[model samples]
Target chain A: MDYTKQIQEIATRLFAEDKIDVFVGYRLTGFDDNQVPALIRESKDVPLLVFNQKSVFNLSNYLKNDHTRNKRVGLVVKGCDSRSLNLLLTESQVKREKLYVVGIACEGVVDDAGQKMQNCLECMVPAAVVYDELLGEANMERRFIINADIQDMAAKELVQRREYFEEVFENCIRCNACRHSCPLCYCAKCCIDQETATLYNGANTTSSAFHALMTWSLHLAGRCVDCRNCEKACPSHLPLHLFHKWNERVIYENFQEHLAGVHEGDRGAFYKYSMQDPDDFIM
Target chain B: METVTNQLVSIEKPEIVAPPDWQPVIIGILCNWCSYAGSDLTGTSRLQYPPNIRIIRVPCSSRVDTWFLIKSLQTTADGVLVSGCHPGDCHYISGNYFARRRFLVTKKLLNFVGFHENRIQFSWVSAAEGPKFAKVVSKVTEDIKKLGPLHLYKKENFEK
Candidate 1:
């Protein structure tokens, strides 16, 4: 992880050469052990780039946002973050030529509590799958594991399972933090917004909460990079991964062990064609 | 525990059941080219279906965004049925295809968050199939009734 000097040097070079209009990275917050996503537009701001366990938020989320969209940008991405960036490229959300990606051979980033995230712990690609520059020492590739929560959910009876998820949906406040925090949720006028949806009366009821959460999750099914940003952003602390992990498991099992954004050109599971895909589920 | 005590009280003083007078409200979003016309045909042929369903016609099934579905659940509706043209037969060519992809993901997410999957339905009904449209509506109504009212988020509102 001791790539601080290297990161600073790269930032300086990008600014000096004017190769990028902005450099999006992480900087340590003044009052806490956590790091916040930083946007550096000038050469003087290059010193703000730092790498440590506290640098948690995926920088890729900012790329699809208004601030960075259509701009020549330099971005730092960890193992998990890189996959998301790769997906953005594959989906044509951003142009590859416009980006100067500084790839990190991540040795796992820790959460605010200094604990490793589940996805980081089981991360198979500890380096950027698609980047213009590489950083840190490459680690051995690991195996992807089905998250434990999803495994436990699979064992529940139909009624019991329904009850378990019902409790989770009950806590949603309809703030759409999960959707906003998500990099994939870039729709200009999201359907769930109050003014746009005539059907949803825009009230914060349990039924509405259930519908909103479900719709958001499904929207990200194959595209989600397991960044867990949505889960972290959710004020209710809902186990959003249960939905994602379940979809991931099914996609993996049915679609030739497909992983979203693992390769630069890899299309999503639904977007691709295969003679071997499971036909039993389709009517 | 407080939970145990509450359960015991509920068991000791059982709530009496009322007669089955509850009629579920179903919100159906029909694609203008196919499902909407199918419902129109049901009216023309005088084929009787449950009056519980209220239809909204959209230009294409893809226009039925996730927000509309959420809004339906929050309103008076007990179930949502999004009916479109068969795959590859959409009036906009690939509108139904996009809807199919979206619906699959939405269904999985809903199931994950604990909403009963039976409460929402996505189907393909051609403009010529009036009987099929009626049958689908009736079937969806029955399915939602078996699950009862969506009280997962509504119980707290009632408690206040």
Candidate 2:
């Protein structure tokens, strides 16, 4: 799963050909095996770029940042990262013509503990769906595995479920780290932050967390790429993936087995509706 | 200086001791073209119904953001009724269809986070279905009454 030398060559070539102004990849933190996202602006720093299982941060998140916005970008993409990139392209947040994407057929990425991420273990798309130079063996198969937490929650009593989530929300610090880490949360002014916390209900901890999480999940209902950027960014380590995965399951069953940003020009499940959409939930 | 804000947040809502006459507060959000007009018909036709609902009008069902429901439960309303035009009956073509997708997800999402599934509801009422609108409101009000008040996160507020 190591493509360090290959990525460096492509990045060096892209810079040499004057095709990209910035190359977004992963670099060693100068101390650990784990890599931090590197935004390389000069060809001399192309050696800094690395691609491996430890490259956990989704580089596409930087596409919306000021450094790369409206600039030519040569970047790397794994399966999940490409999906997020696909969404950004569809949403018109980033133009396709202004970038050169080096795709990777990811096996899986590991966390600090060297364990494969939960989302990767259940990944359906294992290849870079959109890339200019793919880096690994591309295998796209649907691994429709329902997460244990969501299934277990479904089997539990409503009271127990509520009690569990109450703790989850109560622990929230409202630092807005999850929002900043989400690439799709690209609104010039975020809708959630537009209103003061006081304007919501009160500036209480659990209430604000509940409001923020619910609002954030709904905003990303169909478009989330399951990259775990928000989960990684949360200081409290909230099980944020549950919200997105739950919505994904519901949408998959009810809305014609739709997966977000899978096909080109796919406007997400919420944007377009089918006449066959379930109306039984309505009274 | 916090006008129209956080007063709901500061109310440390106590447990519901249902008095013999404590009617549940139901917030009814209706789309202008269909459900709103249907409620108007309910009034004009002298239809007798429970007066528990507080109606708010929106241009279309899709205009109702997900936060509106979350805020309603966290603050004042015991229950919410979001009614829109039936499929293919939308005044703005397919507004309700898009809204319908969101409504289902929002309902399930809220339920997943701990609220009873019945606390938030949805229906499609055409402009001609005045009686149907009355029936829906009564059903929603009844469901909320049984579920009691939304007692989650009604703690004391703080200055952010």
Candidate 3:
């Protein structure tokens, strides 16, 4: 779980060889145990790059930023971050030849309170799926466990669930942080931000929040890697994973347990269809 | 004269829901080649069906974005019906197949967020199936009616 020296050495080597113009990794926040992602452009700053249990922010998201865009970049990735990176690769958002990836066989990153995040506990792929050089023992055990919160919500009555979600959406401030934080939502002009559309017209109303979040979730339905970037980015700290986990569970059961970006060049479930897809649900 | 006016009004708007007359507005987004043409056939065949549905045509089932469904439910729709070609029958060869995956996920996601599972439904209707189209509409209308009016995420309720 501690690869600080190894990562520093790797970044030093990558920079010394002029292999990458940018190295996206983590650095101490100087405030707490939490680490902030740092984009190191010079080898002199390579000493600042750190990787440990507290490196919670998915660094792959930095690849989509201007610091790494169109630049020869090297970045760190955990199991889930690597999956989202694989999606970004499959969608042709980033050219593979232009980047070098340092993968970590993730032991799960911890939150500010130092507890392992929920997704990592249920993580099936603890090793980087797509990587040049992998660190730590690669364990790709596939564990499928439905989250308890989803089960509890499903058991509630329709009225109860509706009221709960209404309050959740009503509290939304429509900041669009979640969209920017997601690596897969790379469109230059997002549909949710369309001013012409009266529904998601950048309003802070519950109706707009419902539209924006629902549309955003559907866009990431089969592709979401449970990275929790959107949840982490939300200022309100809305439990945004509910939308993603529900879709993930449904896609898994209905589409033969298809996980996003598990295999190279594999598209999301929505992109590829099977004749075996459940048809009884459709009248 | 009063009886004559009343009968005339009823005949002109025969599709109106009876009794309380508060018909649930269902949005029907039909793919151009199959479902839309099938609806056209239903019209030409003069088949009687519920008028609660408001049909919007698209190039194919895959052309219908997930936002379309969400926007409808947010704006004025009580329920949504997305109809495309049958499996292996998409004019675009695999449009409906891809769309089918999205529909199932979107339907379930909306349902998971507390919308009724029946609030959004999907179907496959070919151009030749005029009677089948009517049957599907009536079934969806009836299902939505029984579920009552959709108040979830409506702008009127939450507008500032």
Candidate 4:
């Protein structure tokens, strides 16, 4: 769904009516057709809002940033991005009343190479679960399917699997772009940061990568919405989805087939329990 | 005690044979309110379990970070076990309930990444279940022994 025209009109109306103090959307990156997130504070910038295939960044990451905090804001979100926003509301990180949400019924966003991103291909919900005004037609037939890569990883031997992740970890520079780009990693002072972490010296070692990424993924176990922001931000091109999809797949299997951020006020898998929860793994 | 003697005599060897004297270094992260108290009860009651497990008591099993489990496996530990209060019985009221979900995901992830699920174990041993605690420890110890040493995540020569 090409929503460039509709987004421009909505932003203009929201600004003209003074319904929002700031309107967050995407603008042309100036050099390419690809879009970059733009925070427009004035009515004049309303025309810059655009939503197209290249609008891939989950704009919800900006909700916790300094620019949008405590402001009456307007923002656009795709299916996965809306889920993150839903989680932010449930986690008390963002107030739903202070913002206007323009939700999009996404038709699988494509990469720069024009192929459907892996997360989009596996997406089960293509419509926003929470939105003040939803755009586009919802595709109701998609079902939650495990990613092909995860299925392949499951078939490998134990040593082979360890060797694969070893390579993935070795290439990591510990730059933490993945953590910074993640919407759920909104901690004021992240524990994985070397200065604050008491458990392990935050170094660029492979061991540190294992520690940091494992902690990061575990924290996002029941919360990640597969926005793919972390994967897109990684400089090493490491398949960070392996960690998240692993957690997502496991939680789906063991915790009442739970999916993250699909509803308002959902407390996630770890925060709540059911007596029917699988205990065969426990002794 | 009698339970410990029986476990020592009934130990099973894995398909891959190693030296008879090599014992797995198992790290047990036990919750203070239940599993740790249960272990204490085992000692006081003279119930015997394997001595290979080194216990670390945490406020709750949920406090056992996934990093700690992974780091233990990568470092000195040959196997890891996390024991907590039974579901709905956490001292902190829902700490173990949450831990059950966390442990399930952690175990599945480890197994997906080539670590055998047997290398790590999760159990609930209530404060009064001294015999049950002994049985769990012995069972986990024997399982680890049968799988031999866990060299999968060890730091030495892992760079390759």
Candidate 5:
């Protein structure tokens, strides 16, 4: 599971071969074993490219930033990050030819608590969906499981469910960390921004959080790769994953078991249609 | 528990029936080419439909952002109905096709979160089928009437 030395080797080779303009990976945060995503521009910095359980941030987000835009990128992706990479390619947010992806067949990463992340626990795609080279063994046999939290939420009464979300919303400080951390939230000017919003303004009201979170979750309904970046970014530690996983579960059930980023070049759920799509709820 | 008692207090019979002259506010986001034109045809043909819905005509059904529907439900509307051209018949080729997928996910997610699914609805009504448009409206109104007020995130006007 320690791919740090291998990542450094590959990054050095890619740099020597002139295969990439930049390498996006992780470096240890100062004073901690935890890693912070590092964008290595020169070959000398390739040694900073490390991959282990603490390599948590999804590097595909940097592809949208100015640092890697239009530059040939050699990047590392865990199971979930690769799916988002597939989506980024599909959405034309990043050109596939420009990316030299080093995929990881993840054995699940741990949180700060050293506990396995819920996303990794239920991960069906333990192998990178798209990559130039792969590390670790692919477990294609892993079955997809609906998150237990979603099942528990579904069993609650309507009022109880509302109350649960109210608590989640009330705790939100309206910091927009979840939105900023989301790789798919690549909009130059997000509608959730108070200055550009037509619905809810920038105020940190509970109602604004309700609107922003609902809008944010809906936008990611078919595209979220369950990277947990949004949840991790939230200072309130809002179960932001619940909003997303709830949407994912509903889309999975209603949209012919459609899972995002599993297949390369797959259009988002809302970008395609099927004859069998459920419409009984339609008038 | 405190919540259990609160729920008991809130569950009084909600006067399910809409009083006479009390029309349910249903916001209808209709695509200009199909559902809106079809609604117009209903007027031209003197065909009657429930007057409860307030139509906001967009260039295409795809233009109806899910947030707009959610906003309507949270603000004033008791129900939201989004109508578009039949699949493959969108004025903007694949607009309704994409809209179909978006609406389906939004509807399912809202329902899963305990918002009554019946409050928001979707349908395909062509411009030629004025009667079909009327039928859809009648059915949507009836369903919303049964559900009564949504009582979601009603906020007072800020600046506008």
Candidate 6:
């Protein structure tokens, strides 16, 4: 997309105006067709800002980190990233006034294989819902599609479902790469860290791996934006989205089609209460 | 005389036997205001339960961070049990409410990454339910034993 030129132009202007202390975006990693997250502090660094099919990382993860905290930041957000930003604002994780968001009317970003991500393919919002300046021609909202894995999981017998998940847990290495890559996983010391988690040693055993991965996923349930960054960053190529999608599906069907971070001030599903929420599942 | 000496030497030698195979370890974090007292009552009544569980007492269920659960799973425990007061009965008025929300979200994530939901247990136990505490521990112990040593993520030390 010619949006790369627009992004660079904006970065230059932000630097010239001295309005932003740092601009977080993406650049080529120089090893392959993959794009890595780039933080531009100088105006001269604007040339490095390139948006292409390989720019896969969700840069909003940096917004919650200490490095960017309290600093006036100019960030580049695709449709999905912008939604996460919205959630951050609602959660009080980040202040809106401190941010100068460059929103993109995204023409869906590509995966490592250069194919459109399933979330993007089923994208309901192709334009940044909350940005200071918007780019690209906004596409119409599409219908939300239930993830294929969740459907297949629902079809399986209980015993078969257990076996299927057993195989998935068997592949985890317990590196915490998924946590590290996630913007919401900003705990100073993670629960999976060995010294702090004395009861659950960080031994990387299969059980340990299983526990670590699952716990990390649970922490992100309602808050996860289905950005697919964790799944993409994972070395074992685990289907991380199924966890988020299943929760998303449940929230969508049960709640008021609640999408995390769609609006600037919307609270999360669990945070808001309704007298009609189903309690049949609870004894 | 030589035969006598050989007999003595053979008699002095100790037999070498293998240690028992590693048993699945499960750590249960029971809130003091509810589940811990329940566990203590189970002990006072001499209720028979599996010895697999090692319980840690916490003031409230909310104090048990997700990191504590993760770390327990990472280290020695095969499964984790987080038992607290039933909703609305929480000693802090709303500690268990926050816990319930946290557990629901955590359970979803653990299942997503392929951990069998069976490995993590969340329940509500009041101080008066001593038998129930024993039952919960016994059930978790039996379930973990059948699952065998948690091997989905290999212990780094076990590697050559």
Instruction: Please count the clashing residue pairs in each candidate, in the order shown.
Output: 5, 0, 0, 0, 0, 19
TM-score of chain B of each: 0.84, 0.85, 0.86, 0.87, 0.84, 0.82
Winner on lDDT (1 vs 4) = 4
Write the residue-wise lDDT of candidate 4 on A99-127 in tens digits.
99999999888898999888988997888
User: What lDDT does candidate 1 reach at residue A140?
Assistant: 53
- Residue A69 shift from truth in candidate 2, angstroms: 1.7
lDDT per residue for candidate 5 within A49-153, as digits (tens), equals 778988889988889988899899999998899988888888789998988999999988999989988898898788887888999886655856748887777
lDDT of each: 0.74, 0.85, 0.85, 0.83, 0.82, 0.73
Every model's TM-score:
0.78, 0.93, 0.93, 0.90, 0.88, 0.73
Error of 6 at A6 (Å): 3.0
* Candidate 4 off by > 4 Å: A194-200, B1-21, B152-160
What tens-digit string does per-residue lDDT give for candidate 3 at B68-128?
Answer: 8888888899989999998988999998888888888887788777777777899999999
lDDT (Cα, 0-100) at B120 in candidate 4:
79
The deviation in Å at residue A188 for candidate 2 is 1.1
* Top-DockQ candidate index: 2
Candidate 3 accuracy as lDDT: 0.85
Off by over 4 Å in 2: A195-197, A200-204, B1-17, B155-160
Candidate 4: tens digits of C-alpha lDDT, residues B1-160 = 0111011111233535668799889999999999999999999999999999999999998898777888898788878999999888988987877777778788777776556678879999999999999999999988888788865535653444
TM-score of 3: 0.93
Better of 2 and 5 by DockQ: 2
DockQ of each: 0.17, 0.32, 0.31, 0.31, 0.31, 0.09
Give every collision pair in model 3.
Answer: none
Q: Higher-TM-score candidate among 4 and 6?
A: 4
Stronger candidate by TM-score (3 vs 5): 3
Model 6 docking tier (incorrect/acceptable/medium/high) = incorrect
